[model samples]
Target chain A: DAGITQSPRHKVTETGTPVTLRCHQTENHRYMYWYRQDPGHGLRLIHYSYGVKDTDKGEVSDGYSVSRSKTEDFLLTLESATSSQTSVYFCAISEKDPQETQYFGPGTRLLVL
Target chain B: SQQGEEDPQALSIQEGENATMNCSYKTSINNLQWYRQNSGRGLVHLILIRSNEREKHSGRLRVTLDTSKKSSSLLITASRAADTASYFCATVVSNFGNEKLTFGTGTRLTIIP
Candidate 1:
């Protein structure tokens, strides 16, 4: 189970609308990440947090933002969803460093039409 | 751009047979990790090999790293239907420190019963 959970397992929304996905972890891991999976592109990192209020952009971070106000919660938001943003979003956490093994949540399937 | 590339985009094998997948990266890395994603689900960490290590094993899975070639291989012995999934190799660039991982395009393995 990875002791991780993501809200709204599946969602369908129209383009230009704002969307937010939540990830909660019980492991108290210091590092959390958000990634999107797409066909032919693999998994691309969107954002990550090394500590509370400490977040950074990842490989494909455009139009996406993340926040970590508490150790157990991380949220990813899209200011204006786009069709290209329709993908399976996954949340992962590592106990120590990013190089360490990461535990992933069940994932959220978002469809932006 | 630091993403790894997995070889044999897809593979089909019968249950009980061994399956092998290879991954090649472009830059030096501190560590290599393998993850598995079943259909409609998030990924699960499988194994990790350090840059200084040549090989590692856990249960029926074996991982090998060749820094000279910037490549790695994952081997699964006595594969079963449950082992059917997409496998990805991720790398943490040596120069980038421990921040985020760059993932490969992945290899889809189908086990025939």
Candidate 2:
């Protein structure tokens, strides 16, 4: 269970609107990641943060942005929602070991109309 | 591009039967991990097999890695209805400080109880 939780388990927004999903963890892991799952394409990385104020782009980071101001919280924002951004977003955390097993949050389902 | 691609997009079997899923990767990896995602739930880490290791076992799950073939397989013995879920294989590609995981589309397993 990893003590990870995602807020707004479901959301519906219109195109061009702003949307932000939150991921909170109690494990205090150093690495947090955002991923989107879609049919046929599987799960694609959106963005990830290694520590406070340190972030990096992932496989599919074009329409998304992320910020990590604290160890327990990571935010993923869609500046302007698009139909293509509709997917189930999952948050995961891992310890300092790069090869360690990752713990995942419940996930947030977002829909863009 | 995805590092791993799972074979058999979908599968079905009796509750007591054994189930097997295979994953193939295009490049070298530090380790390969298997995860299970229940419907509408977060993914749960099942097991991890490092590139140096040929096989590993966790409970009823057996994972085998063949680095030469760039492939891996997960075998679940005596399956149950609770085991019905989408199974994914993720590969950790380590590049110095830049390390990230690439996940496969997954195999949807349906256990007929």
Candidate 3:
């Protein structure tokens, strides 16, 4: 384990409802990221934070928003859940290094019903 | 998307057989990484190969990067049934603490015992 934990490991929600996934890391890494994994799309980045209060959008940031209030917690929120938004959400952290090798959490599986 | 494309979307082999998965990307990258994901879990980083390096080995895993061809290959020797999982190749482009990784659809490897 990379000292990372995701809340609500499995979730089922209806359409148009809001959902939030939380990622917490104790490694005190400077980089944290959120990604969604689907059948054919592989893992697409949604958002990332370089440090507390510093964040950026990733390639597939649509329908997703993220916030990092502190160094250890990164939150991903879906304003309104949709069937298309159902995916396995992963949180990864990497130390400040050249390679940027990410260590991932156990993941949270979201199902939009 | 400039994401890596993995060949042989699915592979099946008996235990003890070697497996090779190839990935080809469309653009220049600073580094390439391999990840493995088991059912109902998050992805685990396997290895990383820099653009400047040609080959690297980690135990039974071997990774080769050929920047000239924009390609990389992962070789697993003496595979076991426990090794069955999905393998992905992610390419990292750009730096400056805002790194983005493009991932391939992935190869589903089934090691039959």
Candidate 3 docking classification? medium
Error of 3 at B38 (Å): 1.2
What is the fnat of model 1 with respect to the true interface contacts?
Answer: 0.82
Better of 2 and 3 by TM-score: 2
Tens digits of per-residue lDDT, candidate 3, B6-46, equal 98899999999999999999888899999999988788999
Q: TM-score, B chain, candidate 3? A: 0.95
Clashing pairs in 3: none
Off by over 4 Å in 2: none
In candidate 2, list every pair of residues with a backbone clash: none
DockQ for each numbered candidate:
0.83, 0.77, 0.68
B1-113, model 2: which lDDT tens digit per residue? 67899988999999999999999999899999999999999999999899999999999999999999999999999999999999999999878978788899999999999
Steric clash pairs (candidate 1): none
- Per-residue lDDT tens digits for candidate 2, residues A8-78, read 99999999999999999999899999999999877888899989999999989998999999999999999
Q: For model 3 chain A, give the 10-residue run with minimal summed lDDT.
A: A92-101
Prediction 2 global C-alpha lDDT = 0.94
Clashes of each: 0, 0, 0
Better of 2 and 3 by lDDT: 2
- Give the residue spans of candidate 3 off by over 4 A: A97-99, B95-97
